[model samples]
Target chain A: MASDGHPSRGLPRSIRNAGWYLLLSVLSVAVLYPVWMTIVRALSEPFVYINEGQPFLPVAIDWGVFNTAWAEGVMGRSMLLTLGVTAIITIAQLVTSMLAAYAFAYLRFPFKTVLFVLLIATLLLPIEVTLIANIRTIRELDWLNSIQGLSAPFLASAFGIFLLRQGFMGVPSELRDAARLDGFGHIAFLRKVALPVNRPIVGSFVLITALGAWNNYLWPRAAVTEQRWETIQVALRSISVSRPERFNVGVAAAIIASVPILVLLIVFQKQIIRGLTAGAVKG
Target chain B: MSLSASAPIQAPTRRRRSSRVREALLGYSLLAPAFIVLGVFGYYPLYRLVHFALYRPNRFGNGEVYVGPSNISSVLADEEFLDGLWISVKYLLYTVPTGLVIGMLLALLSHRRLRGIKVFQAIFSSTVATSVAVASVVFFGLVNPKIGKFGDVSFISLAKADSALRGVALTSIWQNVGLTFVIVLAGLQAVPDAVIEAARVDGFGPLRRLFRVTLPLISPTLLFLIVILMIFGFQSFAPMEILTHGGPAGATETLVFKIFQRRAPGQISEGSVMALGLFGLTFVVTLLQLTILNKRVHYGE
Candidate 1:
């Protein structure tokens, strides 16, 4: 089965391998073009491309755009803000979802099925539809100009709880019974037994949820009225859309904003890929 | 004496059952904080959406504000709202199929056991990490024509509505293609070699095999992707706000964009109605797709 090509007998496997490599190289170029262009623009003068009229490559390379973005807090301040917000949201969401999931998976309570189903139903409703009312609520709470407002509403995600509940249900019943017999309380059993065993799943959920929070634009934009508290995504938007004429500056800002996510993807590509596949597998 | 001892044993059993109930109640208590948050933020706003959409506050009395029949009529009657709906529908029509196609193409290309499949897969998927705003900005640079990478190309200006939509769609499709590929590739890998062998033995050609076997087997996955993609398409806002700004002439103003503008902190009446409209549109479309795809997809053993 490995070498059964009838008409391609004249062509060696080495030649075939070369052809595949060539095709892949062309693909690699196509995939990397946008990223390469972004880097080139980010490192160049603000109006160099505009002045040159048709510079495919940077005419004058400098770190001025990064400097500008950092000074403007688009890169430096917004990046830190986004990171902090993402971290807090991820941690809060994880803990909440894990605890709720443990209850659903292990505890026997009245109306358990009904409540769990109700929680899961929220997944079907588009959160965007509720944005207006949510904003109003946030304003009322005086959380309109703070990170607490930005992250609070979204910290209790039905999707996260659902995913973790499914993960928790896969644990054997005997393990829980054993922990119970050993005098572990419900919360203690969950933290010491269920959680430690499902580290991979917990890690996957954290990465995916963090990505969602990091990339979230609408809620943060709607809730955070103060410009100083802007996340990197919102900051990027302010730079790009608000200053449409400054093509180089806008592009530079975009490059700065995207680099962190790109770096994260590179570092966790394998886990990310696995996690993505896992979502599709059961569906 | 034995009967008396047996009768007494049941008392302890009942007490133990009560203790179990207490423990379970404790678990529920521990879970209360998260549930309260979910209820107020997640469930409450959804319920309020209907109320807000229906009742136009006395603050802005156009008497035409009640939700009963007038609000629905007003939503359907507004020309700008209709236009926004049209644009969003057009976007969905273009984006959903295009994403699936491009995803399938990329997945197929990289699915083979080749030296660079991993590298290509990684690069193709890099777009998944980019937010909508970032994608919009990158494409904005590309199609600037006056100062873009393709500035020399005559067809690059975003001033034209069609061109703007096309540009946004292209960037969107590029960013989304990676995730789609990753998703479909998972489905493809799950196809058993024995099934392919059997199909080959039955004298079915590659194309036939793909359509008849591979597609049917992966229908569940494809359906999931389609539903998710259409939902994402309807929710598209950043691209419009950042890339085209509803463009050359409100060509790319999606329903979500209108909802955003209306609900902009101060004016709540029109925005509430628009938000309700957007919600209805998404809900109906999602449910319709789910029902339609239900007949086609078969989750198998």
Candidate 2:
């Protein structure tokens, strides 16, 4: 290091290093500012900035918003309902996807490739496009105003199967053969060999599926008809629409809706990052 | 090796019949639950939507009554439908390229090695965790007509110019910029460092290397990003619902909102048609993207 310390070389290196540090600090602030604003608004007195006409900063903090949001805001009830729906959908989709992925990845059959391609191709079909017809189907099943109406539609994700199949394919064939030689059946082999090895991918899918379900607004909005049957997202919309004047309350509701996701991010921040970036970057 | 070696020998002959049976039964059984759900929830509704789109709702409001081809012609002929489609197209034009450019820029800046870089990356993707409702709320407050930063600022509000559609679109771009940024950053990171280094060694500048080296390498990720963005954009509902309520006078009435508005709780037929219309639009976009980029994707480790 000392040998490379020519005066000109060190000068440029120091300058560039400082420049990089400065740029990163600026970006970090830009990223954190919105989150800080949300937190401030949530914790502060209702319409503090609006009433005072002061610059939008948290000068005073109040915890009443949380109490109000919990008691009067649709956050608590809708959140529980949303969680229940998300859990059922996630579990159902996971089981269905895992089994389908196992069959697709390991099973040998006529038209396997065709079936797999068709399955993956369905990913291109956005849920919105299918909503009109699916709604009708739900009505036909008399599923309206019920959990079955909400949870029945998205129980199988083609995208999940595709992701899991890729994970399964990465497992070595020797493992499968070893299971076979031990007189283990296909289900047992999958449980012993595939599931255990691909637990991380499975876990990632669970997180993704749950997040997708939890953040879901349109499908739940479309399916659940009754006001009380609303998901957190639908409830938030209702609150904002009804009380456009209470800017602080709306922000509180927004914060309330965001808390679960924030908690989830803190708990499973690693998995979310990995899941998001996996398709983009190589290890 | 020995297992494969054995695969071609005794196991094949001994287990062939049973394996075939096991495979067949397991294949259908595994698929059964999904297939039933898909059929009931997906395919069945698609059939009904198509069927209902050809019909007129009964005057008595009893149920959908088939009038055949006329309703389709009417929907096609409707000026409102045409305008809606045009508005949607305009939204894509504004959102897609702007999102990509902004996303790429953010990703490039944040993808570098710096102190607390992970935190910056998290912030960049934090929008993914924010629901549309929440994001819209933030923007709504910021763009408050009276007291908001942009609203009181005058210069920022001028671009909005009392048009809720343009206003909501601007807010949407702001809210969603983070999402596309995260996705594209992932794509950018997937580009190998070796390739970038080679380009640099060849005397290519940063911009040149980005265009020549990085862009080509990450085309698949870009395509994937675009498809996902476009789909979500088309399906976007809550922002329009919450921010403008599709209003001053139906300026932000998007495809999804239109479907929801057209159908009542049990009006499956009309709902299905609108839903199918959205599906058809997205399906075409997906196929177009695949066709355009399929040859360019270099699948490798």
Candidate 3:
């Protein structure tokens, strides 16, 4: 509204608004156009699609291709396996990060500052840097082709600890003292007071972690040798590579793999955005 | 009564000392799980990575023979390694600036107080839902040169060796645009309204105000986005793997993809060296960014 009254602008307000709307609408369409085409490609018959010069809309719709992709790609099994791995990693991250954050926030300890710095320093050593050695470690542990290997390396996250610690620090010290006076121990105080107050942060962390685990690509490809253990991402790749003729089947598989996360994005849109921009934006 | 009164002072001191020790133990116990996981997975692998780079597996296949820094030296001298590094840098150049400009434009366009603007915001950020793998596949189909929407046109050939990296970069830019938009918009939203109003009152035109006032105000966010986009660009693997498979002449083989391809047992030592090289490059870039840009960034405080 403050910008609406600017004196330098020559265009009228209504006309300016209309221009903005038009530009935004065109951009939105450009962004969504590829995705819409993918859906059309997936549903249309290959022969009909090509004959029709790949029409913008599906002609001679074929819903059975989804079933074929689901079966051929083994998407159902991969989806379940991915969901399980995601659960393991997300829950472990939340638990370990909460404990670490609580200790950092409220508990007294030796080497507190040193440990915190060390933990944060791991941020520099991203998984990409350690990919080779980690694969070796997983092999040594005999965790290859196992869910444990897939999820083990990501069980704890330095970023999660830092974020949760920030959230926990926002809990007033007076409340902690009050909780202590009421015979609440460390765990009880965390459960009753700290966690409830930081629910939004926790929720954001959950969605972010789950999204990362579910969409993990490189590690899963390296860790699992068996088709049964392949995550949805790895499965999609194999389907695409193995069935070049049935490109639409691969597209169908990609769409299937994306639906769950897209639904999550739409439902928890705010939390996901906040989670992503957590440290980037200052209060 | 005299004994009870005398014990009060001594008992208080002893109890306080014990309670402090108890608190310290509790803290250590609470921190143990995260430390254990990080030590085994995060820190240990780093140590082993260095060790792997310095040693070659013995002929017996049972032990490793220390070869000093030969692996690192050879890896540096290798032409393929250099090509991969160059390609990664080229990718960074291609994706980061384009993504930044586009993301900034989208954020600025949508940062108005108009009716039903939330719908547009949602659409702008919707690309976040697509993972790198999904985006790559979608783009692969769209640019496949045969059945693609733009495949029939002859003016621009995406599947060719010269433009293959550009093709992968296009997919990456699209996938990452949502993240960039979100971060930049958050930064834009944080800019105080009074600052913009003051600029307008000072008779600054729209473009001039954006450059001088708004841009400086959000410089920190922009810098953060640059660092992140650079990292993503360097670490990019899926787009290359899916779209071109490092392409007609290894044009899109980033350092990470090269390292990934060397996962076999014999090549582990060499791969370790390359991985460390990637780490060194990332560290230098991040440090360079902070040192050079820190002076220019304007903190609100």
Provide the clashing-pair count of each candidate structure.
Answer: 1, 4, 0
Candidate 3 chain A: worst-modelled 10 consecutive residues by lDDT: A1-10
Candidates in order have lDDT scores of 0.73, 0.70, 0.84
lDDT of 1 by residue, B250-295 (tens): 8878888877777754456567777778777776766766564445
Output per-candidate TM-scores for chain A, rounded to 2 decimals.
0.90, 0.89, 0.94
Shift in Å, residue B221, candidate 3: 0.6
Pairs in steric clash, model 1: B54-B67
lDDT (10s digit) by residue, model 2, range B205-234: 667876777778777777767776677678
Report per-candidate DockQ.
0.45, 0.43, 0.49
TM-score of chain B of each: 0.83, 0.85, 0.89
Candidate 2, residues A22-94, lDDT tens digits: the string is: 8757866765666677667666665667666535567667778676766777577788999999999999999
Candidate 2 regions with alpha-carbon error over 4 angstroms:
A1-11, A51-54, A110-114, A277-283, B1-15, B152-162, B265-272, B292-301
**Which portions of model 1 show Cα errors greater than 4 Å?**
A1-10, B1-12, B59-68, B150-157, B201-204, B285-298
What candidate 3 gets wrong by more than 4 Å, as runs, is: A1-9, A49-53, B1-13, B152-158, B286-298
Cα deviation in Å at residue B20, candidate 2? 2.0
lDDT tens per residue, model 3, B173-251: 9998899999999989998898898888797877888889888888888888898899999988888898878876777
The TM-score that candidate 1 achieves is 0.90
